[model samples]
Target: MIQEMAETLDDSGSAAPRLKQTKQNRQSQILAELNRSPSLRIADLAARLDVSTETIRRDLDELTEQGLLNRTYGGAVRPLSTEPSISERHHLLVAERERIGRAALPIIKGGRIIMIGSGSTTTHVARRIAVELRDITVITHSFGVATVLAMNPTIKVLMLPGEYHATEGANVGVHAVSFLAGFHADFAILGASGLTVDGPNEALIECGAVYSAMTMRAAETVIVADHSKFDRTFPSRYAGWQQVHHLVTDKAPSDALRAGLDANGVGLHLA
Candidate 1:
């Protein structure tokens, strides 16, 4: 009986396929999917990875055990509780920024006072505003954005003064927020470090406070971000979904975020 069982096991092709699903290979694939979507269904993972649903479920279970993901009813989701570093986020979605900025252009009317927060994506929005709109006043903490807008003859620039961060090339401090607090804008175009179930978030506490104040002071608050920011959390919480009037992001809004915004009665504009 032992000899016959050994022969059958050896002849079975299933052992080879099971052995092929190594821990390293599974983790890599899971990370790739997690990077693309904040949450994924088991069936979706099976389709994407070309593995059985059971294999994907096992992989997700292992990832959850490692604290890399949180396994839920149907599948798994990227952990929202963890905050990623700002340096880790530089230049992640450049193409998405351009797309988001282009989508935001028509919404920005000419000759209005606009408050732009500093970030790669928001800076791109400033560029679009400078090129498309005339007779506009731009208030920003971004030195780079100010320099670009200054080249346009019709656009007026108002730069808030504060301690400069060499990495971000933007000002952040009490001084910057104080300067912004005094002005009321037609629309505030802000960049977000992350977005969570709670709201739009920022990495720096001071920047979050300033961004929140700016949103409050503006008639409308429009958040411009790439898809990467969605469903992610930051160290600091700024404004909730209700505080935002509109969201401009690259590609269509995911069903999860869209549902959240819809529930809050906020509009979403996909670039």
Candidate 2:
């Protein structure tokens, strides 16, 4: 019987793991996923990491207790402040931003001039835009938007002069608004911190004036936002919904929101 047992153990290959999954390794992975998205579901994390649900639950519990993440019903999210920094927002709602960026591409086809708004979603648009024309020109206040679009050798980048907000990685203030006064564009692509029924709004007072100027200078306005922006209001209102010709987003708005968009003649493009 001992000889048979020894032979069976040897035939089973290796009985011990070459590398073990430690608590530190699991916690690092959990934090990484949270950084990539605003929220991460426990079940999805378990499936991706090849761990049991109970194991993931325990990991989340420990992480939350350490103040690294905040738990929702079944998921975890980054602990955000009243105003999250640009670095903090860069990876948030990645899929939603990609879809919204693709949806807005048609609006830029055959355009001579385009104005880009400053924000992470608009930054995604700058990255995703397929440059078909060599003579196309882009105007903006965002350092990030300018840097991304500059990757295209054929496109001309016009950066507005203003006071730089280190956190936003963009320029804003009276100087930016004044510089925008001298130019005109065929279309203005704007991003908002919040999109209420009344209009598009900005959380940062610095961006409010310059964004308002951008909207006024362009002939057409398209607001690119994820569903997370809806029903939220900020103090500074940049432009009314009637001024917004198009709204591109990943999720459908509520019936009340639909009526508001209809009343203002804003075309909602579901990505």
Candidate 3:
């Protein structure tokens, strides 16, 4: 009787882990299916995973709470592509952004003016620049970028004049674009909401205009983005692939995006 009780306890302990793994695997399968298409129905997932509809619904609810996907009426869809506010995005993909930021440092030459656009990834680049580079002038409309660079006494921060966007913590308007046009820079380091085969894009048209001006005014344009931005397209196509000179990212572009970058002679640097 004692031996049988011990054996039963061991089996229960091991079965708990097996059940946990099964649930995790099921959720992963749900995400994978959603990635393949746009949305996933609970009935389809249940049939495919060989689980009950209730199990799929519970999994979807848990995934939604974790912000991995959005739960719909009878299914789930990929997280909305709409750009999140800077405050929200700044906390997402932090490690990847830091790596991408560090990778961008080599492209900057000392004693040259660089134009930076406003975004979470670009703010990471600014932080790296503050610590790594010196005696460089940074032209930007981003309050966050300027504040980061201000810590380094050697770097000069130029704040552009425009309408201040509180959520983005950046300035954007005709004034900012016109001010940027008046001066040229050695390099332009900008971030993107999404990057696709067509090119890098911004969520806001005002910010896109500022990025567009920076790309044209600089000799070489470097786009800093993470894997999350890959294969995603936004409303504003700030610069075409031909205008972008280098892409500093944590992951390599997809096949279609790579072909576009190659056709345009854009260099890719993976962190």
Best by TM-score: 3
Task: Write the candidate numbers in order of decreasing TM-score.
Answer: 3, 2, 1
Q: Give the TM-score of candidate 2.
A: 0.73
Which lDDT value does model 3 have at 178? 97
Instruction: Evaluate all candidate structures by whole-model CA lDDT and list the values in order.
Output: 0.76, 0.81, 0.85
> How many pairs collide in each candidate, listed in order?
0, 0, 0
lDDT of 3 at 131: 91
Worst 10 residues of 1 by lDDT: 1-10
Q: Which model, 1 or 3, shows the larger TM-score?
A: 3
| Candidate 3 local distance difference test against the native | 0.85
Which pairs clash in the backbone of model 2? none
> Mind sharing the TM-score for model 1?
0.71
lDDT of 1 by residue, 1-271 (tens): 0111122234654443223455567668778877765556788778866679998888888888888887655676667564333333444456768888899988877438999887778878888887888887888888867877877898888888898876667788889888877889999998887776678898667778778878988999999887667676668788989888888887555578788888888788888
lDDT of 2 by residue, 30-89 (tens): 898877676777899999877798899999999989988766546666653344678778
Q: TM-score, each model?
A: 0.71, 0.73, 0.74
What are the runs in model 2 whose C-alpha is more than 4 Å off? 1-81, 130-133
